[model samples]
Target: MTGETIGSDSADDNDDTLAAAGEFAVIDRLVAGRTQADAVTLGPGDDAAVVTAADGRTVVSTDMLVQDRHFRLDWSTPHDIGRKAIAQNAADIEAMGGRPTAFVVAFGAPSDTSVSVAASVTDGLWDEARQLGASIAGGDLVSAPLWVISVTVLGDLGGREPVRRSGARAGDTVAVAGELGRSAAGYALLHRGIEGQAGFSELRQRHLTPQPPYGQGACAADAGATAMTDVSDGLLADLGHIATASGVGIDVDRRLLDGDRQAVAEAAAAVGADPWEWVLGGGEDHALAATFPGALPPGWRAVGRVLDGPPTVLVDGGAWAGNAGWQSFD
Candidate 1:
């Protein structure tokens, strides 16, 4: 708690910058208790803040995006990166059938970077925060070789139990509530130097700035979703998470993904790549996926069904033999 500023007290103007202040100094300045949402009992300075849930259940998830590994400064502005980072992390909370209440961020950047860039990044973070009526709450700063952003989100259950991935049973319908494959298509368009294409241009933008379906996760929960997850990884890979977590089998019908596949088909063809790979195997879409026992609520579309037997994810009643999506290590 030492050296942590009390209020809007701006520190001494120095060429020192973030690096000179050191990691802890910068973090102390950033997180020195301002105001917290009613949901957070303890804010920063602890190992982890204690977030209270109405039903005594806490929904938590973490995500890390490396500069080159997850984003490129050449393609995405700092603002876009900030929004995407927050949006994707919040989507994970939605997948658990909860609403994000607070977020704690850890950011690493080069010392020579301008303060304007960091301010733009903060603007993006706050911009996205207002979307869910949440606030930045607390954060940390550190010096690194390249930019690295990590966000941990805390969510409230609103008195409802968390919808875990291991609860989907056979006969449950598989559904999605957000766009799929757009980011991947956009990435392809950018990488291939496809210029002057309207659709590809939109796809490229989606790669830089993803649009997560806010509130849809809680909607699924209220509708009695048995299992759910966000498509941070490929559709199959993410569903595989629910399958293993819930001890159920998931089978995706490719035909059901007709809309998703077609949405990026042209870009795939232009890049001489299979659209199904993006549809079935591409990651970072952050779409909401869940198992519904009845008619899905508005903004959702059914794509498949839960299956009996082993915990696995299948495509068209068979195994999908494609690049199973990206991973930290090959």
Candidate 2:
């Protein structure tokens, strides 16, 4: 925490809510003593913050998280929510083969929320941003019936052409970086109310804070990735996007995915669910999956290959018959 008083000049600093302390006072507490990344020329306090785009090309993406819909306050602390917000947005830049440099966040909560709670969320956002050598440049705070966080990320592509979903081609290798299905396994464990095992505990924690493969996006670009995307929506669903966009088919070898299935097999049995479903259909892992010509990159593992046939995803050369991925309205 920043350890800054809510209203240092007022006697109610220790007990003030956002309403009691007022907007400016609470904002001061949230931004107090936080350091900005080198790319952020001017941060929080003016009409808007200035950020450097040294590559002359900036990649930007935004996402919003709603209370009880995207996250449950009882299950996720303000800190976890904040980290999650930053991670997901950063992953978008990474998928484009760019490096994140700055972020802008907007937060909304009830007026009765404690100033300390807001500070805790700020701390989480900063903690996650620091991991990528980025900064929270600016943001807005407002009153709402429940918590809502919206984040916009700024990235630099280092003069490299962006990796896009439409670039995959037949004869290219489909590979992935970082863990798969772990977050879904953790969500299952949490949803089923199972706890106690050390392994299970770790999985549960991953569901709250995903560990996306940072810096690997630029690595994939440098290694000549033809197409890339983060596994936010299940592997099959996400790869299907690439397939459709590239007008090609993707055939995933089940044997290649045994590791991910094995990782969650025990949890699946405990929850009375199929491990393959989590491996093939679970989303929110935020891992990077890409198609590359020639050899794979250092951090990527071959999972499948692009095909000359129809625009669809097939597992073990056939269609999968389970939940393909997550849909907002489903």
Candidate 3:
């Protein structure tokens, strides 16, 4: 039984599971009344979606989130999971200094899952995609043992050169847009089962859904950013990529990140963990980090400076002796 309300014409299937409601009915509920972006000349119901790349170049990236690996149903709703999936994938496109134009999603879940739940997830995807002025051009659904969400994003560079990770120079300034460490802090609170705190609720919510700094990628590119990347990995780990690719050293001043540490200080105290670790070593925040040749743009904050040396990332001129970031294997 579905036992969930989706506010669709198929509301009668609220108590019906995916197996009972059938695939086409569920898909109709998911795509009904959704408007496509101008870039999407052809959307769902077509054999293939046609997206416009006015610059004659398309930036593409894909990501997959498995149940209990990237998220947990007990802690996140289907809608939250959907938004998280789209947001994370869009960040990759942003990292290349492009704007997302279209997305195609594939979802796998058990047949016993409620149709309403699946519809909610689709709604979440559309909600987030709408924020980027993009559309869910097309997708597929299938039965599986657990919920697996895979999303592929297509973006346009708008005639600008794609900013790569290897372009950072010795004298460039390392800057960042958007907050950090909230996701890790939220995870810590949830893992410890801590609750009813004043501000911790926001942190917990952050773990479920990240708020990436949209539009900042194109802004950074317009400002002549030398190198750019999103903080899907920890700050140190992501910066390490730029350092390695550019063959330059990077030193981050801990003091510059005091605001982030302060934002999670209370949660850290309650959990007996170092906020610095979360601020520096945490991932999934999806913040934009980049290197600029001169003054950073208005929304960007100066965090460090690229150095002339062997490729490495240092915090306060020393190697950070904490968990650097997330790893798929270990």
Candidate 4:
């Protein structure tokens, strides 16, 4: 998830600031001309919104982003921040083998911020939601020192059991859906101020807004996924959670991930960094990783195998000595 805080200088005198528009007017602009998903029974304009849970249960998750902490306005636009906020939260639903149905967002920015910027953010939220056949049921706009966004996602399992992170067995194959290392590599490029490369811009955009494999979570579930999670953190760190939960060890073959390394090898070279580190330890790709007992499904490739041993993630049969993933504090 991500948030924003911006300077008022970006807004022209003709623009209506948040304080000038007032909270109600600003919120009206945010929710105007929006369509609700089928799951949403009632949308904004009421005291509360309602969404239907067809399977008799609802899957819910929430995440937040802060200025300078989760995002930098100078690097990303309000629209990018909005898309990222929705994508990351939706990933949590997908990781659990559910379909995202609706989202409720809360945004906080300086009173002097432009309403157009806020509307741009809402446009981003709705555009991304439309891709998954979801809706932005409702949200709140508030005054704050910086841009901060918090999103809550509601999902449906469609009568199937939810896939968790604790069902791996000794012989299960570990597989991943979607490409890896792109976002991390993008971050590296942006951080180092590298530009004008053929592929570096795409990498930087990936860092601004991730592209999670949307429907692969349900496909993995149907294909008999025993355990699952989205790779928001580094691959090794995320799999380590599965290892601990399932009481099994995971061994990844570096050769299996060479393709991902190659994808970012040029950018890594430009920055004088190791592409393998990004492939193994880079996080925020939002890719799906799961353990399956049967043939891998389409769009998923096997990267390793479950082992009968102490719970841990090993690289090429040994421990990894480099950074394993992102840490909120550090």
Candidate 5:
């Protein structure tokens, strides 16, 4: 009972690790003073939270980020990691043409982790959730050897059907709602230990925390998108999924992606890597890539076209012979 309190007003700063603060106190600190969105009828402090799904249907998705695998503590602050976790999960909901309503996070970190650090992470979770007009309804904290953050997001489809990967037809246009290759460019910069340049600094920050094109999924759906997905895996690899599912070929025009390539050209030069590789193969950008039947929606740029062929993703009608994407085992 003589442990350090975990709330924001706690006086003790030193020796304020999770073990020192205890579980219930830390949970209280994470939930304290937090406001839930209107969809969340009941929030933290109960066995479970209650969220409303107005359309009599709910879209749900889950993602897990492990330390060193999905993120690095040395490169990303606890706050950045929290934001990344929420953004990626929210992107999944967006891919389904839904708006995220609530999130339940389950976090595990070493007992020696500082309570202040945990609070910062929670703050980041709340911050990013607010961008989607959502809230963190509830979550769990547990002791582990390394950091593991898992998030489950509940989304509303707004009476629209969820866009499926199998819906892309041969003639549909492939459009993207957000920038690509920045995260990969940032990763290359971080990997090469290159810093100090103002532009490179921006790329590095992007690697730590992604800026997902929020609200575009619904827009794409409203614009008659036939198939949709988020660019979490490299663009080519993710598009390959739609190709495989829809039994169509995707031909990406490199010319159409020049802007993305140019955005990272300088950083690529500094790191001695090809900007095209990152633009085509880099992952974690979380940009929304959808196939539309007609003109693209606002904020979307045409990048490719669905083709009538075998299930494959082609760059300029040829296969790309570079590292195409992230693999959990590799």
Candidate 6:
């Protein structure tokens, strides 16, 4: 896409090709001069970049978004897809109670695709990176049958120990920060073609670009959080990760989440869907959910408490009966 003019003479247009310019040149153009956060020690251009953890430990995670499986060209522009991809990946690092520092993206699409669209996607990636004081340190591009985006993010512990799912003691309180069920609500709004619904715009936008509680991950880590994870696999299923990992039980009080339920209630009614499903069964919200030993950090709201039972997540002291969570094969 580079070196070609808007209506450059045919000679110039014909001269540009992936094979001629090479992958390195394209990647250089994409990554050159971008800034990395303080947390990154070795960013891009290496086998794997090293991220500094205050406690000398790192938190890393990866996510892949396949065309139509995670997004649609009709519903989301390439830019939205790119931002969503990074946001989700960053959320994974945050789930461990760490601050996102850098991202590496691998992009695949048809060769005939406009270089401009690819640039647009990179623009979106950088846009989101700017929000977190992070950088797109490296990336890969190749020809594929459809658009496939994979992102891996590295995070810093900020001197605090990494928060794992296995640390929640029985008495730790469960809490969350950031909006829940909005992405689920947005998906419903889009699928049902519901229009002009009050406060639905934010929900719809959430599906396009999730608002991950950007800096809260570090806050959770600093606040003596026993365990933490982002809400990407629905509230209960994500909690299940902590439960299974820690060999402990979690009980979520439904009453504490009524505010979230109320927030999405109107959109649920418009589509004849259960608000609780959107709230409890929803994923992709990227909200921070953690277990704390005492008062929650400034921004978190208490939702429940850790229990002594077997590894499981319960709502209102019981199992939830709706959809469990999302899986690639399902």
Give the whole-model CA lDDT for all candidates, comma-separated.
0.82, 0.90, 0.92, 0.91, 0.91, 0.82
TM-score of 1: 0.86
Candidate 2 lDDT (Cα, 0 to 1): 0.90
- How many collisions per candidate? 2, 0, 1, 2, 0, 1
Q: Cα miss at 38, model 6 (Å)?
A: 5.2
Q: Which window of ten consecutive residues has the lowest lDDT sum in model 4? A: 1-10
lDDT of 1 at 13: 49
Q: Highest TM-score: which candidate?
A: 4
How does residue 90 of candidate 2 score in lDDT?
Answer: 97
Query: Candidates' TM-scores?
Result: 0.86, 0.95, 0.96, 0.96, 0.96, 0.88
lDDT of 4 by residue, 1-330 (tens): 222324455545566888989999888878877878999999999988999999999999999999888888889988999999999999999999999999999998888778888888899899899999999998888988888999999999988899999999999999999878999999889888999577899989998999999999999988899999999988999999999999999999889999999999999999999998899999888999999999999999999999997999999999999889988887
Whole-model lDDT, model 1? 0.82
Which consecutive 10 residues in model 3 have the weakest lDDT in total? 1-10
In model 5, the worst 10-residue window by lDDT is 1-10
- Candidate 6 has an lDDT of 0.82
Stretches of candidate 6 off by over 4 Å are 1-25, 32-57
Query: Per-residue lDDT tens digits of candidate 1, residues 11-75?
Result: 43442455555666655555444566776777777676766667777678889989878988778
Clashing pairs in 5: none
Kindly state the number of residue pairs that clash in model 1: 2
* Candidate 2 structure quality by residue, lDDT tens digits, 1-330: 122322333334476778989999888889999989999999999999999999787999999998877877767877898999999999999999999999999998888777877887899999999999999999999988788899999999999999999999999999999888998999989888998478898888788888999999999999999999999999999999999999999999989989999999889888999999988898888999999998987989999999996899999999899999999875
Candidate 4, 92: how far from true, in Å? 0.5
Give per-residue CA lDDT, model 6, range 150-227, as digits (tens): 998877766666788889889889999898899999998988788855689878989989999888888888888989
Alpha-carbon RMSD of each model? 5.6, 4.0, 2.8, 2.3, 3.4, 4.3
The better candidate by lDDT, 1 or 3, is 3
**Selected candidate, larger lDDT, 1 vs 2:** 2
Q: Which pairs of residues collide in model 1?
A: 166-246, 186-203
Clashing pairs in 6: 54-159
